[model samples]
Target: MHVLFLAPEVWPFKRVGGLAEVAYDLPRALAALGHKVGVVTPKPRLSQEMEQGLERLDTVLEVPVSWKRHLAEVYRHQEPSGVEVYLIGHEHLFDREGLYGNAYGDYEDNAERFIFYSRACLELARTMDWRVDVFHANDWTTGLVPVYLRTLYAGDPCLKDAASLMTVHNLGNQGQFWHYDMPLTGLGWEYFVPEALEFYGQINFLKGGLVFADMISTVSHTYAQEILTPELGRGMEGVLMARRDRLAAVVNGIDYQVWNPADDYRLAANYDRHDPSPKARCRQELMGHYGLEDGGGRPLVAVVGRLEDRKGLDLITAGMERFFEVGLNLVVMGYGEDHYHVALGELAARHPGRLGLTIGFDIDLAHRIMAGVDMLLVPSRYEPCGIHQMQALRYGVVPVVRDTGGLADTVVDQRPGVEGTGFKFEPFTMEAMLQTLDRAKQAYDRPQEWRGLMQRAMAQDFSWQAVAPRYEEIYRKALELAGQRQRA
Candidate 1:
């Protein structure tokens, strides 16, 4: 089977969040399973630097946009396992410093930019004459790709039979815009109804994909169920409910080659499941880096990623007093919300060596922190899927995550007789998160139980090896659904 993955950003060249991580890992996993897989994404400004060992295939074609005719170049890279990647380079949409917009806001023309990319993807597949069995679309950026397959190319022999699977990374980012832009997508006002692109009288790209695509997926099984509710759907539960039969849940996986503890160059000492000596060295390095006391008395807990309301960071912020009172050392990283940033800095200043804080994105520090810390904190209000927790688990660091989305699906609660992987909290409140943290702190007292939990988390395989076959099944299901539609 041949599959085309459509996204706004790809890994290494452009990474905004977990979507890029999934885009990077899943296709290669599928290719390893003996499927012909290809990807089309807006070439990032850093693409040239990241294109080492990749060959420029050729100038594909002139792709049309509402603004201008963009010349798209196709580049290919074969992984060690024989998976292929094709990058679509267009200067106008992608020649920017960042994958997402700058600190101010999102790109003003994101809708138009992604619409152009989706159209170019279809054109490339048609010109190459590839019998694309499945077109796997990610997030809201490439949402219109499925719409094009089902509407514009519905009757064309070259495209009519191609199936599609659309994954919604987050429900909030629905690419909502004015209804007038429907014509620009080559679809008419007819699609701007309650059942199609419409969401409360506005146009929604993700909604269109959910309504028109052969099958729909969210990041995790729990998330698949979450989005069908009024509280979590972000105003699209009605449409999702109508198409629940075609909806399924397959959790995301990590690239083990990069995330494996034994081979990771980011750590001070590399250790695997067998030998745990290197982990102590890494922990010491982490403590030294953060100015925390390198001792076994107090466990060091690390919190990473954006400091926003949605991350439920307020829970942590509100519970700082308890941490200091309980003699727990905390390390905080990543950036968001000016007020939260200021408050955290003040907490560190007041607590002296007990608290460590870094205010922005640093890839190297992230890996080191994960490896060094005894526990990771991820208290999200509603996480579709989080990659950092998986990274922490791989490093033998138990994660204390809110029991929602992928966290619920992956983390097994380490209570008495449970034999779980990590600590899980419910209610999405400060008290609940604090209770879970207290449990993690309690587990730190018993070294054998802590080691057993760490070993369990490390032993559990979250790699794409176990997940790709499920995706293959999804593709086959999409093809079957498309065939049924044709017969009907």
Candidate 2:
């Protein structure tokens, strides 16, 4: 089977979140499984320096977006794993410092920019000799791929019969635009109804994909079910419930090659599940690097990723005093809302040595933290499928995640005869999180029990090798659905 992935970002070229990592690793995993795979993404300006081996293709695609025609330059790169990556370059649209926008906010033209890229994806596919059995669209940026496939290219030989799978990484970020911008979609105003692209008079790109795609999927089974409720749906629950039959979920996987502690060059000391004694050196280095005073034998807990409200930063802030009292040292990395920056900065200042904070993301620092931290905190209010928890597991850093979404699916709370990998709290409140942390600290004090938990986490597998087959199954089901739709 031949699968084509459409995403706004692909790792090592351009990345903003977990979607990029999924785009990077999943294709290669599928290719290794003996299926032909390809990826289509916009060429961000920064990728030029990173992708030195990129080949400029002779084919120039004239992509139509509403009333305008934009020419897209194609660049090709062949991965060692036999996956083809096609980057569509448009200087005026994509040659920006950031893939979506700068620090100020999201690009105002995000809707128009992605509409052109979605059209270009189909146009580029038309030029290729490869036949795509499934066009996998990721997130809101490429949501229009399925919409266009069913509308504009309905009669086209190459794409008409091809099924589409729209993967919603985060329903909260549905590409919503002003109603006036509906013209940019090149679809009839009739499609602007609530049954299709419309969301409270706004042109919702993700809604269109959900309505038109052969099948829809989210990152984890729990999240798939969560999005159908008013609490987590972000106003798309009714539409999702209307088409729940077509919805499916698979947990996101980590690329062990990139996450394995044994071979990670970024760590100060490398160790696997067999001999994790070297982790002590990594812990010492982490403490020294962050200027954190040694806590005698206190657990070094780290919170990694964006400091946003949904990430439960509020809970962490509320529980800071309790955390310090329980003999736990905390370090936080990743940047987000200004309020969180100020709040966390003030907290870190008020409690010097015990609390350490880094305002931005650093890949090397992330790796070192994974190896060094005794426990990783991922107290998200609602996580689609958290990659950090998976990475923490791979490094034998026990994850203390909220029992919601993918976190619930991945981490098993320790109980008698359970052999769990991590700790889980049910409610999204500071008290619940604190209680879980206290329990984790108790377990930590027991050296033999802690070692057993760490070894169990490392032994568990969440590799793409185990995940890609599930995608292949989804693709086949999508193909069957598309065939039935065509016949009808």
Best by TM-score: 2
Top model by lDDT, which number?
A: 2
Clashes of each: 0, 0
lDDT of 2 by residue, 129-194 (tens): 557899999988888889998898998988889999999999989989999998998899988998
TM-score of 2: 0.97
Error of 2 at 180 (Å): 1.0
Candidate 2: which pairs clash?
none
Runs off by more than 4 Å, candidate 2:
none
Query: How high is the CA lDDT of each candidate model?
Result: 0.85, 0.91
- The per-residue C-alpha lDDT of model 1 at residue 463 equals 91
| Residue pairs of candidate 1 with colliding backbone atoms | none
| lDDT (Cα, 0-100) at 104 in candidate 1 | 78
After superposition, the stretches of candidate 1 with alpha carbons farther than 4 Å from their true spots are 51-54, 66-69
